[model samples]
Every structure is written in C-alpha cells, then in structure tokens.
Target: MTAAVDTRPDTAPRGIRRKARAYVALTKPRVMELLLVTTAPTMFLAQGGVPNLWLVAATLIGGALSAGSASAFNCYIDRDIDRIMKRTQGRPLVTGEVTDREALIFSYVVGVASIAWLALTVNLLSAALSLGAILFYVVVYTLWLKRRTPQNIVWGGIAGCMPVLIGWAAVTNDLSWAPVILFMVIFLWTPPHYWPLSMKYRDDYAAADVPMLSVVRGRSIVGLQVILYAWATVACSLLLVPVAGMGVVYTVVAAASGLWFIWEAHRLYSRAIQHVAEVRPMRVFHSSITYLTLLFVAVGIDPLLPF
Candidate 1:
C-alpha cells in the first residue's frame, strides 16, 4: 500500500504570545463553556441537591480537557476545509499558526492525560464516558460524517449530548432516566442552534463541500427543520422539571423559557418563508443558547429556591 500523506503544513517560527494564542484557539473555548454549563445541572439533578465537591471538580476538569483534545483534533482534520471557509479562515490550523504535528501531539497528550485523571481520581465509569465522547467527536463526527453527508450533525450530535450522561454517571455511577432525558433535550437543541450559524455561512460551507443542512437543502427546508427541532427542544426542556424531580421554581422557569423559545422559532419560520435574511434565524439560535443555560441554571438552583 502507498504511504499515507500528512496533510499537515508548516507554521512560522513565531513569538511566544502568538504560539500561546494558537494553543488557546485549538480548545474552542466558547463551545467548551457551553458544554460545561450542561454538565453542572446534571450533577445537581442526579443527587437532587448540590453535587459532591471533589467529584464534580474532577469530572468537569477531565471533561473540559477531553473536549479540548477532541476539538483540537477536529481542527487538525478540518484544517484544509477551514481554510476555504471565510468564517474559519483565521483558525490556528488554517492560518499555519500551528502545525498538524503540533495539533496531533497536543490532542493525544491532553486526551490521554484527561482520561487518566478521570480513571484515577474520578470513577472508571466517568473516565470511560469521557473517552467515548472524545472518540465519538473525533472519529465519528469530525473525521467521518462531516465531509461525507448532510446528516452529519444529526448523527454526530450524540457526542455533544454525552456530557450530561458523563456528569450524572460521575455522581451516581448509574445511567439514570434523568441524564437520558437531558441528552434528549440537548440532542434536539443542537440542530436549531447550529443550522442558523450554518445558514449565515452557507457559501463558505458550499466552498468547503461540507454538506451542512444549509448547503444541501434550501433555506426554506432547513429553516423548517430548525423550527421543528426548536419545538422538540422546548418539549424536552419542560420534561426536565418532572423527570429530574426539580421543583416548582424550575417548572415555572422552564414554562416561561420554553414559551419564548417557541416564539423565537415561529419568528424564524416566518422570516425563512418570506425569504428574508437569516438574521432572525441567528437570533433564534442565540436565544436557544440562553434558554438552555437559564433552564439548567434554574434546575441547579431549584433546591435553594422555594417552590
């Protein structure tokens, strides 16, 4: 067989600050923060109280590191396509701020180190869950589905949905119904959140041949899907209060938030049907983020708030 070609390119002999920034860019901080937000509530909900201090800390740290590693590997894999997308053109890998060798080594080191910490300090179940998330993200989502199919995000959203499972397992060592419900909430939420961003960058995705919903289906169809997923997410979010044994405080907040989420989706559908710019879809996407964070935070604080 012929030797595999390394698609990785060279980087500059750079200053320390630039090098540091490249390493930081590999982690995709905003995405990691959002992932952690989901993790925190699962911990609290699992116990129906505040989570254990040490275990929560260990799991979050390990989860964040493993997430970063997988994200870095994604950058490595998508470097070429990223260069074609204006939105991702400045990414460290695309810009040659870091080499593929550097990224690969960094990803492997962080992934192994994070899993090792989880196995030793946290429970083995948590470690295995974290590793599974990484593998799903890197191997299934980034490497396989992304380039080949329009359904990539639909299937690959599983990796993003795993943090709640990890958090619950970290505490109870059991895969309870609560975390599974939480997974459903996030899984349904992913499409509406991402498709709008993809709509905003449809030309870039087309250039990269990435087969995003926005690139494959027309805007009308994708917008409808976003609305449908938005409705599903709201329905799933409402289930959290009863399923997780959250209080009336959580139920009230969820009902209110879910209403706003549905409103946003309706607005997006209206705009898309009219062939308006995707600004409304983008707004819905941002509001979806706020809705999830607020719903989960409400869940986390339910024990403190009187019903």
Candidate 2:
C-alpha cells in the first residue's frame, strides 16, 4: 500500500491551489454535500423545528469528517480501478497528487478525530453512529461488496442512509419509528439515485471490472429496477406524514415530488424499451437529486409551520 502512487503524468494538477484541491477531492465533497442534506432535515424533524444551532454545527462538522474519512479510504482502496474507469480516471489518487501511504494515514487520523469530536460535542450515540457509518462504508461497501456483486449498492447503500439515524440520535439520543422510516426512505432511494448514473457509466465500470447494476444487467432490466425502487422510495417518504405527524406542507411536497420521481423512472424505462439511441439516464439521475432536495427541503420547512 505504501508503494502505491498516481501513475498518470499529463493529468495531474499542478501548483499549491490545485494540490489543495486534490486533498479535498479525496473526501468526495460533492457526495458529502448530498449526504449532509439528508442529515439536517432529519434533525429539524426530530426537534419539530430548528434544532440547537450549536448542535447543528457540531453534527454537520462531525458528519462531514466521518464522510470524508470514509471517502478517502474508498479512494485509497479503489485506487487501482480508479485509473481504469474514465469517469474516475481523474481522481486525486489516480492523478498522483496524494500517495497511498498519505491517503491511508489521512483516513485513520480523520476517522478517529471525527469519532472523538462527535463524542465530545454531540453525544455518545451520535459519535457511535459516525464510527459505525465509517466502518460500514469501508468494510461492507468498499472492500467486501463493491467488486464482488452487482447488488453491492443495494445493501452497502445503508451506510449512506445512516445520516438520518445519526441526525435524530444527535438531537434526542434515541431511535424511533420516524427516523427508521426516514432511513428506509433513503434506503429505497439509493438504487434509483445511483443506478441511472451507473447506466450512463456502464462502459467505465466494465473497464474497471466493477459489476455495477447497469453493467451486469440489461438497460430495460435496470430501468425496471429503478422504477420499483422509486415507487418504494416514494412510499417510504409518505410514511413520515403519518408516523411523524407531518403537516400538509410535507405531505403535499412529498406526494408531488414522489409522483415526479416515479414519472422520471417510467420515462427511463420507456426509453429503454424503445431502445433509444441515447437513453440519457442522467436525466433520471439529476431528477433523483432534485427529488431528494425538494423532499428534504420540505422536511425542514414543514416543521417550522404550526400545522
């Protein structure tokens, strides 16, 4: 592992600013933003309004660190394959901005720091959840499942869903049906959110020898699965309306966004059936992000209203 280094010569970023960006790139900040999006809304719902500002700050920082640590470990672990996939070919590890030893050491230092920070600033439960999330992502998702099965993200995506539970636990230090249902909502949302992206990058995965669902399954099959998961994701989103006593605001937004999400999934399926030249799976992928943002935006907003 210590001998691992970026092999690409022409693509590596130069200068200090670019190098700094490379270090940050290891954390997969874009992915971290999406993960953190789900966290705050769950906290807002747990508190029935805005949670303590300090608690919110602490939770976000801790969550970010934990996510960054896990992502860095993934970058380190997948360094070899990252070089093969066109979409991943520009990663910091593949570009040689960061050494394998440096990435591994960074992963451990940040992982431990996040656990300690959350434990001191948030609560033991939140810290515990952070630790569990990091461990699960590295052990279950990256190492154990990612290369071995096309169903990898199906089970491994649970690590991404932990933010809901962590957010709720940070506020109340207890688990309930509400957070559990929210967790399930994300669990269901994962495939629809990811499969489309995988579909677009099927060739990349094929080159990497990583059997993502879109690589292993036919386009129509992937589309059908996306639709199924979209339906389930929508169903789970609505569960919060009754379980959490969510008001009309949340219920209406969730139902409408869910319908939109389902529509996109169906459109993707239709294109697959017709064998469209360019399926544009990214349309569905982009819509999934929009759907989650709108749904969680409602989660935060609904709690602020009296209803």
Q: Best by TM-score, which number?
A: 2
**What residue runs in model 2 are displaced by over 4 Å at the alpha carbon?**
1-14
Query: CA lDDT of each candidate?
Result: 0.87, 0.94
Q: Model 2: what TM-score? A: 0.94
Report the C-alpha lDDT of model 1 over 22-44, residue by residue, as the tens digit: 99899998899999998987788
lDDT of 2: 0.94
Candidate 2 minimal-lDDT segment of 10 residues: 8-17
